[model samples]
Target: MHQLMHADLARAHLHERLADAERQRLAAYVVRVAKARRAARRAERAREQAQLRLRLLIN
Candidate 1:
């Protein structure tokens, strides 16, 4: 009975660790996605500005 209780407690601890790791991983992924989106937006704006400059030079 003592061994059984020990086993159950170990299992619970493992599950909690796994849960915390998953939450951290998910949060990191969210941050990465946000950064990627911001980079894309900046690239798009830069492209537009470059094109406008080209048109002005041509005209």
Candidate 2:
């Protein structure tokens, strides 16, 4: 009976560890997506500025 209890406890611990790892992975993914979006926004702003400069020069 003691052995069975220990086995159950071990299984629960393993599941907890797996869940924690998944949470960490999801957090990292969210951070990466945010960074990518920021980068894209920055690039878009730069493109707009360049276009504006070109139009000013043409006029």
Candidate 2 per-residue lDDT over residues 1-59, each given as its tens digit = 99999999999999999999999999999999999999999999999999999999999
- lDDT, model 2, position 19: 100
Off by over 4 Å in 2: none
| TM-scores, all models, native as reference | 0.96, 0.95
In model 2, the Cα lDDT at residue 4 comes to 100
lDDT assessment of candidate 2: 1.00
Q: All candidates' lDDT scores?
A: 1.00, 1.00
- Which residue window of length 10 is worst by lDDT in model 1? 1-10
- Extract clashing residue pairs from model 1: none
